[model samples]
Target: MPLILFNKPFQVLCQFSPQEGRESLADYLAIPNIYPAGRLDADSEGLMLLTDDGKLQHKIAHPDHKEAKTYLVQVDGVVDAAALARLQAPLDLGDFVTKPCKAVQIAEPAWLWPRNPPIRARADKPTSWIAITLEEGKNRQVRRMTAAVGLPTLRLMRSSIGAFSLATHPLMPGEFVEVEAEALRVGG
Candidate 1:
């Protein structure tokens, strides 16, 4: 089965079709027949898995499988111990409560690429980096959770899904590497 690990860039749509005035996967990926197992918002950047194998795709993307997705997030304000505690706790997001996940303050990753339109910087306000790992994929969940705790996410990038990490694979934005489907295990 054809399995691909793609480093999706900011402002690039997750779909493989063309979109007027916006970058889509078609701009970078020419490989046919493979579809994204999951989605990353156009504003978020990082590792995405694509595959032609339906079974493998379901295993990777389905929330029931509980594959942990790790992100390197840059929030607009300083994240103190209290904020970090809130982040690690199960958060009530109105529609649903987020599952308890790992959250820790981390130094900015030196390997991260700069976004084309840089995130807005406030001269007076400070920014901080944090690592968040979640087993469930929700729509703009990370952004919303941070905002609820008074730390708005400025830049969000998913660094890994399950055991497959962008750091280990080392693909630049819009670049991809193909691997055998069996090489990856769900929830690993």
Candidate 2:
């Protein structure tokens, strides 16, 4: 089976099922029988994988496989080394302690498309970007992590998972490309 790499837009629901007035995967993809292997929250935007292959979907989305997921996070602060260090070191998130992960301050990516409605802008406050990679992507982990360090997340975008990446396969919102399942570092 083939894999669909979709760049989901902000506010789009992650599932195909209808949800009141909001748009869902069904609106963007016409491919039948394929379902999202993983998901992004309705408020976040980034790369999402959809496939009909059950085992492949499990490897990619299940936490036990330990596939790395990297996020380009825009936080509500002038990000500092202290925050980066805190992100790298695992601070307990109440429910779980994250395994140590790579975190670094980064310039806002030039390749990124501007969000449609856009995040709030305030003259009194500033924002910064950081790249954080973690193997486990539980519910709102990145946002909760940033908030734990006093740097609330303003925008979140997943740039890569395992071997597939946006750097190699740049996609605008609502676009998708099919790739050979074997080409993925995971499996068919």
Give one digit per residue, the lDDT tens place, for model 1 in 10-76. 9999997887999999898888788899999999999999988778888989998888999899998
The clash tally of candidate 1 reads: 0
lDDT scores in order: 0.90, 0.90
Per-residue lDDT value at 138 in model 1: 95
**Global lDDT of model 1:** 0.90
Enumerate residue pairs that collide in model 1: none
TM-score, model 2 to reference = 0.96
**TM-scores of the candidates in the order shown:** 0.96, 0.96
What TM-score, to 2 decimals, does candidate 1 have? 0.96
Task: Give a tens-digit lDDT track for model 2, residues 26-104.
Answer: 9999999898888899999999989998788888888877879899999998988898898999789999997889999
